[model samples]
Every structure is written in structure tokens, then in C-alpha cells.
Target: MREANHFNERRTAQAAAFLLHRSGGQLPLIKLMKLLYLAERKSLELYGVPITGDKLVSMPNGPVLSKTYDHMNGAAMSEPGGWDSWISDRAEHMVALLDPSMIRTPEQDLLQLSDSDLEMLQSVWIDFGHWDRWQLVKYTHDKLPEWEDPQGSSQAITYEKLFQVFGFGKEQTDALIERISAQAYLAKV
Candidate 1:
């Protein structure tokens, strides 16, 4: 299992790298904006953070800004002169604001994590999307016990961990939970 996880991580990293290279070392402004939007939305969902109207404003000149931020005050933030830098900064800021403890290396908490807890977390990530969530689950699972029950109630833990990792707020988390529950129920039918 560990080997498989390592392989998956390596593959994911490689895929991300390839994606970067394919885009000439810079994702287009449109793609970056999309990612930013997803990050913000996920953050809001998992962490209970309200998506401020201001956060929706794109960096200046980004595609879709006219439609998304037409009524904003100042110009969109500058594009940082480089795609990687701009995206990285946006991601870091969005994640940090959504869950400061998650992104803050020295302030993280894992004292209550168990093996089953880790598995459930991985499941959540697989259910959600990929990249950040998957990486965070793998990291937590690797460091926690694997002997504990994997079927325990995990609502709070799942919510907290996801908020920590993905910066998703309460509304986002609730919606996701509802969506996942509905999907699971439908699958049984």
C-alpha cells in the first residue's frame, strides 16, 4: 500500500510537471483563474469561510474578469509578471486564508488522527478531486496509525481535515457532504 501511494504521488507530481511544461512553464491566465476559482470555492465549502465578494475579483487582465468582476473597485491585482508566481501566490493566499492552521507549517495538529481516520480521509479526497487533497491525505495517513478502526464516525474530523487541507468552508463542505451522500445513496439503488 505504501509503495502504491508512493507511485501515485510520483505519478501525480510527474503529471503536474508535464502539465506545467506543456503550457510553456506557465498556465494561461484563463487556466490560472479557473484554478483560483476552484481553490476559493473549495476553501469556502470546507472551512465555513464566506466567499467575500472581493475575492472573486481576478488579477487584472485575466480572462473572464469583465464578467466576474466588472463592478469591482480597484483594478484586478497585477498578474505578477509570471504565471507560476501568480498562480502560486494566489493558491497560497487562498489556502492560507481559508485555513490558516492547515497552511501554517508550525501550527498543524494531528494528535487525534487514527488509522481509520486516515483511510476515510483518503476516501474523501478520492471522492473530491485530486492534487492538494490527495497529497494531504497521503501525508496524514503516512504519519498516523493504521491499526485503528477505519469505520468510525468521521464527520467532524473529515470536515476539519478537509478544511485544513483544501481550505473549504462550511457551506462548501455541507454541499459536498450532501452531494457525496446523495451519490452514495444513488449508487446503492
Candidate 2:
């Protein structure tokens, strides 16, 4: 799968909302971020596509959706496709869906994801949503082979390293990354 090579605000918000709604309309910021990262990584591993086209990074806590992290910290609220409308700003290190009740049905929430996309989010919730934020942080940093300790700083986690961990050899990984990148480029045109 290819990275969107950029953040997709609408899809990111929708995914976050879906997760937050499933988690009872609120989640600790770190927990929410870990869930999204796991979901994105799972999507790429399973279908060669990501749920959100956001950059991934290894922070001191764990891996996260880079731009989505920014939004959680109250960035880009006024920008198109941002989470401002769907999610409440972080308060006491937690965030909630702005109108969790508004997500009436699975069909109506289709802001940008397909059935497969929705399914992936649910799967992530089932697998890791129950973990407390600290549990998630430990799992990501200790269990996930892709994340490196960034110490007191952050570092980019590339698809290349993840693919390797997923058992893709160099050539195969390069080709897959190239194809995904071309798709991302064409989508921009």
C-alpha cells in the first residue's frame, strides 16, 4: 500500500470520529492516536492501502498520525477537512466527538471511507481499543517492530521499514511504494 504522501483531513477526522464514537465519545489523546496508527498500519499490511493518508511518526509515546496529532493539539481547526467540526478540542488530555449523537448510521457517516475502510476501523477497536493509553504506548514501543525510540524527540517512520517488518523484500517494497506513490501523485492532478 502507499501512503497518501500527505494528510487527508476529511478522512482523518472521519476515522477519528468513528473511533471516538466507538470508545464512548471520548478518548485520552494518546490512546486515540495509538488506535489510529495501528489502524493505518493494519490497512496497509492487509490491503496495501491506508485508512488515512496521514504521515506516520515515532514519538516518545508511540507512533502517531502526524497531522492528526496536530489537529488534536488544536491546530488547523479552520482548515477544510480538519477535525474542528467533528471533534472537540483537547481538554485535560482528552478529546471527544463534537456531536457523537450525529453519527446516526454507518451509511450516513460515509464522509470519505468505504465499507472496507469502516471495517478496518472496527477491527482496530476490537483489537486494541480496550487498552488504556499507557498500555497502548507500551505495546507500540515494545511490540511493534517498526517504532524506534525517538528519545526526547520525534522521528519519521517510513513505509520502507514497515514493509520490511511485514516481510517484503527490498525490491518488492520499492515497487509497491513506487506504485502507491504514483497513485498518490495522480490523485493530486
Candidate 3:
């Protein structure tokens, strides 16, 4: 299985904020994580890119956006920059938007998203947003090939493995990988 690029915290934070805004400033933590995963997965399928660039991990529950999950649960050692400026409380298995004013519009938080990205996110929301946490979990476990019984251990889901599951042509996978690699490189420079 081919590894994907490293997690991008800034992008993850942006995605979190966008979801919070979309949900009207509050979402159950598990539901938020599931939505993020579904949106990223959809983005990958449609555009060969994930919305947040976060690492994807396979857990017993399903596939999760690892770094973003950590942020949502306050597990990260240091919160991603700008995270505290907007997302305020993570309590009772829920994450709440601290400041609605922090973002003038969802577009502001979603600067990285292209028109296609927005469309995919919308599609994901339309399809999955109403499902409660458990329903989302069932859908993911049933649908995503990346999911495996981690047996209580988190397993990394590499893009290389995912490409095989998605049945994408080699050339398409190569182009996606190349673009992702370039973006990762550029983020560091």
C-alpha cells in the first residue's frame, strides 16, 4: 500500500471550521468526524484529492480523519494554529463553534476548495448529513474498503491501498499521487 502525504493541520482546521459553520455552529463529535471522513472520501473519488489532507486511519468504528479527530477531541499536543480562534468547546461528545463571526463566510474557511470541491462536499452532506452517528458508522463500514476491524488498534489506510480499492486506473492514481506530492512539498516550502 502506498502512503499518502503527511497530515496538513491548517487544512484540517479549515475543514473543521467549515463543517461547524455548515451544521450551524454545533455538531455531535462523532457525527462531525464521520462527516469529515465522508466528505474527504468523496473529494478523493471525484477529484483525486482529499479536502483536508489529513491522515486517514482505519478504526473499529470506521475510517477516520486522524489528525482532525484528535483536534476535535482535544487530543493533539498543541492545537493547530487558528483552531482555538474559532472552534471553542469539545464537550459531551460534541464540538461547538466558538465564534460564528470568526468566519465571514464558509468560503473564507474553505479557501482551498475549488468549485468541484464545494460540489462534492455538498453532495456528501446531502447524502450523509442527516444520518446520526451510528448510521454513518454503518454506512462507512459497509461501503469503505479501507475499514477493517482494527482489533482495538488504529490502522493506517494508505492512499496506495485505497487506489486499489477504488479501482482507479494506474495513470489516474499516478496523477493524483503526483499532485498530492507536489502540494505537500509546496506546503513545506
Candidate 4:
């Protein structure tokens, strides 16, 4: 995971499920991606860590959760409890929860999500959920300092770069990234 920067599919699934649940169990693919990217950005800003811990990348549309994007596009996941378990296949560029039944109760646990993760999801929703998909894209392109125009290709958006934008110095950013890598390694073990 440290070398590949692979994410916890189960946690990411729950995060996606939580967002889809908030959007009445469905959202356009780009819209859902934008919402998840924004939530991850906000979490990194406020909590000093990303909610899904997925690798971030700047794409043509905007910033994206790379592996999550692959999963959204029906790529085979290497792990169980992946996006397919919680969300439906892309239908007309829209995604819905596979089990709206599980999302019926507001009190029910969204598997692998933490309280802080939920807080960030709600914060992102309150701040930008009502905006249309294009609006969210525009905001990410224009407002977020971490995103670089990939110019027809994608570029990794490092936690170091994001930390710099968040007012962290080089030493601190390097230390934090190293810590995160160590943690990722330990989790894999």
C-alpha cells in the first residue's frame, strides 16, 4: 500500500455510500466524484488527513480520487468490500446505492466510516452540495490551489503539495507524509 498508494476499499466504499445516501441514493458520476474530492480536500484542510486516504490526482475535469475513479468506472478491485458492494454500476453516468435498504435509517452505520469522516462529508455537503456538477468542477479548478491543469493528462496531487497550500512547512509536510506511509505499511502488515 505504501509503494502503490492503494487505498482501503472498504472505507472508501463506505464514504461513497455515505455521500450517495445523502444524495437520495444517487448522483451523477462526475458529481459524486467532485463531492468526494471536495470532502477529501476539506478533511485534509481541517483534520490534517484525508477521509478515504486515497491517492489524489488532478485530472482534466478536476481533482479526483484516482482508485475510486477506477472503481466508479467498473474496474476490478483487488480487495473485497469495494465500490461495487455498496453502489450500483454506472447507469447513464449516474450511480445509486445497491442497498438503499441499508441507508433507510439515518442512524444506521455506514460501514468503515468514522464519526470524523461523517462530519467532513456533512461539511462538504453543507458547503457545496446544492451546486450543480459543473459548478463544483469550476470551484475545484478555480478555487483549490492544489489542483494543476493536467493539460490532457493527469498528475499526482501530493499530500506534500496540499499541505503546503494548507500552510504547512516543508519539514512538517515531509514528516506527516512519512508518518502516513508508515501507517499505511503497518495496516498492510
Top lDDT hit: 2
Task: Please count the clashing residue pairs in each candidate, in the order shown.
Answer: 15, 1, 0, 0
Clashes of 4: 0
Query: What's the best-to-worst order under TM-score?
Result: 4, 2, 3, 1
TM-scores, all models, native as reference = 0.24, 0.92, 0.89, 0.92
- The Cα RMSD of model 4 versus the native structure comes to 2.2
What is the model-wide C-alpha lDDT for candidate 2? 0.83
Q: lDDT tens string, model 3, 37-142?
A: 8888888876788777878899888989887777777777544464565677698888887787777876665675567767766777778777888998898889
| Predicted candidate 2 versus true structure: per-residue lDDT over 80-181, tens digit per residue | 645887898789999999987778865587568778888999999999988899999999989998888899898888888788889988898887777767
Query: How many residue-pair clashes does candidate 3 contain?
Result: 0
Off-target runs (Cα >4 Å) in candidate 1 are 1-24, 50-189
Q: Which stretches of candidate 4 lie over 4 Å from their true place?
A: 1-6, 104-107
Winner of 2 and 4 under lDDT: 2
Which residue runs does candidate 2 get wrong by more than 4 Å?
Answer: 1-4
**Candidate 1, residues 34-96: lDDT per residue as tens digits?**
333343333334443322111232232221113222212123343322122212333321311
- Write down the worst ten-residue block by lDDT for model 2: 1-10
Clashes of 2: 1
